[model samples]
Structures are given as C-alpha cells and as structure tokens.
Target: MLKPQRPLKLLIIDDSPDFQLLIKTYLEDFGIVCLFATDVVQATSTAVREQPNLILLDIGLPGGGGLLLLERLRANLRTAKVPVIVITAQTTDGLESKARFQGAEEFLHKPVEKDVLIDTLRRVLSRPPTQQA
Candidate 1:
C-alpha cells in the first residue's frame, strides 16, 4: 500500500479540461498524486523532472500525438522503464496491442470507469518494476 509519506504519482497527459479535473479528483481521493500536462512539451518536461510512478497518456493531442510521446519516453533512459498506460477516445482494432508494442503497459478507452481506473492503477503499481522482459 502506498503511504502518504511516499505516495505514488501519476502523470496524465491530456488536452481535456474535464478529464484532467475528473481524474485528478478521483485519484487524489484515494491518496494518489496526479500531475497534469496539457501538451507534449509540458508532458516531456514534467516526466523528466517529476519522474512519476506511472503515465496515463491520451493519443489525440495538438502536436505529434501520444504515440510520439510514448516513443520519446521509451527512448529516454530516465523514463524508459516507467509503466505507461495509454487512454484514448478511439476504439479501433489492434489499438491495445499496438500500444503495448509501443511501450504502453495498458490501454483504456475514453470515459474510463472509476473502478477500472483504480484497479488498473493498483495492479500495475504493485507489479515488480522490472520483470523478465
């Protein structure tokens, strides 16, 4: 269990104001710290400086999109091993597999349910940082 003295942090990179508020409020209610980045530039800087325990990324953004961000994160040694969960509005086939291949450990469609969000977070956070990869 994560204690207040050492909370698990999640960086959510999305362009939606409503989503930012909703996710932040929900996660904070359960003692998880949430950071917001509305764009690629901010997301990159925050990921480097804050070094959040997890990243929840949205694929549709103003700039190069979430896939590009995921690639960048994977290339950067500092954040390469951090678990990234991709969330998006699209429900196209093979999206999840592609996300995993591109370095996202999980994928969620838009309007993510509270229970699913919490469960995924807990499960991923509880896993060993480096498995037999």
Candidate 2:
C-alpha cells in the first residue's frame, strides 16, 4: 500500500508574535503545518528550506519588507510558483495592485475576518496550479 501524503505546509511572515500564535491556533484544525518568521531573513531561509504550499505575508516585515521578499521568492524557481496571500495593515494606494502584479495570489487587509481568511485560503489552495501565482 502507498503512504498518504502529508497535509499542506503554510508559512506566516509577520512581525507580531501574538498574530503568529493566533494564526497557528486558527489553522491547526485544518491539518496544516504552520511555520512563523518575524523578518525577511528568517522568512527567506524558511521558505527555501520548507518550501511551503502557501505563504501569508505581512507587508511590513523587518530587515526586508513583503514586496522585497516577494520579489526574491518570484526570482527563485523553487518558490516562484508557490501561492502567496498578502495580509497586512498597510493597505495604502496601489499596494494591492502592486501585490497582485508581483505575483501574489490575493491581498487581504489586516484584522482579517476569520471566515474570510479561511475561505480565501481554501479557494486558492483548491485551484489548479495553472491558475495559481
């Protein structure tokens, strides 16, 4: 008999420890393995090592911001096609457009509604690879 594949891995890149805890707790029931990174350096390294199925990125990371990291991720073949959702408080002019143009699957505002976050993630994950960024 063949073994079952593991559940998807998710990485959350945010500066807040509390938010990381909240995301972990909320997503645990979905059978996802959650990883945290408080800054770009760690986020980059973790992304390379873990190669998560999805990434929830905060725009205002320390060392390097989400946009920079997104660029780096897009530049790398291994991580370039991974789906990413930008969840951030900094929803300024054109940020969402920029995020989408930079290859984010979605851009969600901070204080994300629990249902919205879960639903968006589910929808994104369910789509075919051709439809994903």
Candidate 3:
C-alpha cells in the first residue's frame, strides 16, 4: 500500500479579502492548503516561515508592494526555490515581463477564472525547479 500524500501548501499574497476568499474556495476544493498574507511584511515573514510549495502573488500590495516581496523571496534561501505565480490588476506596460524577469514562474491578470487559475497552477508546479548555479 502507498503512503498518503500530503496536501500542497499554497501561499496567497493579496490585499483583497474578496479575492482571497474566492481563491481559497477554488483551491480548497482540490485539497490545496491555502495560506494568506495581505502585505509585503506579512508575505515575507509567512513565506519564510511556512516554506510553501507554491505562491500566488498579487502585485499591488500595501507596505512595499509585491514586486519588492518577490525580489526578497528570491534572495532568501528558504523561499527561493518556491514557484511564484503573479496575479495582478495592473496592466501597465512591461509589468508582466518585469515580474518574470524578477523570477515569477507565471503572470496572470486579476479576476482570473477558476479553470485558468487551476491550469496555470498545475503547469507551473509540474515543471522542475530551475537549478541555481
């Protein structure tokens, strides 16, 4: 008999309670354990402490913003290997590319549909982690 698998822990960094609730509902249905943080400070500490398997990040956060937190996460050894999917309402030029350049595995717009969000998460998490030199 095979051992039971542990649920994947997903950290969601977003400022909106509505968005958090929506995402939590979507992910929990699939047995993903959802953790949350509303701002850069909370996001940073939670991420380092929890060491989640993946992160769903929102760009426009209070405190220092999501990009800054992403950079810090990338720099930190504990959370550096975790995959990050950036979901944001901002449509400013080059934001997506910037997030990717800063180490986000995927970029998604706000109001992400359930199917799209699920597919993106699957794709990103399925890929092997990049080797650090």
Q: Note the clash tally of each candidate.
A: 0, 0, 0
Ranking of candidates on TM-score, top first: 2, 3, 1
lDDT for position 16 in model 3 = 95
Question: What's the distance in Å from true for residue 109, model 2?
Answer: 0.6
TM-score for each candidate, following the candidate numbering: 0.92, 0.94, 0.94
In order, candidate lDDTs are 0.85, 0.89, 0.88
lDDT of 1 at 110: 84
Query: Mind giving the per-residue lDDT tens digits that candidate 1 earns over 1-133?
Result: 4444677789999999899888887776668888999888899989999988899999987678898899899988788888998999988888788888888988899889988888888777777988401
Error of 2 at 99 (Å): 0.5
**After superposition, candidate 3 runs with Cα above 4 Å error:** 1-4, 131-133
Winner on lDDT (2 vs 3): 2
Model 2, residue 35: what's the lDDT? 89
Q: Model 3 Cα displacement at 124 (Å)?
A: 0.7
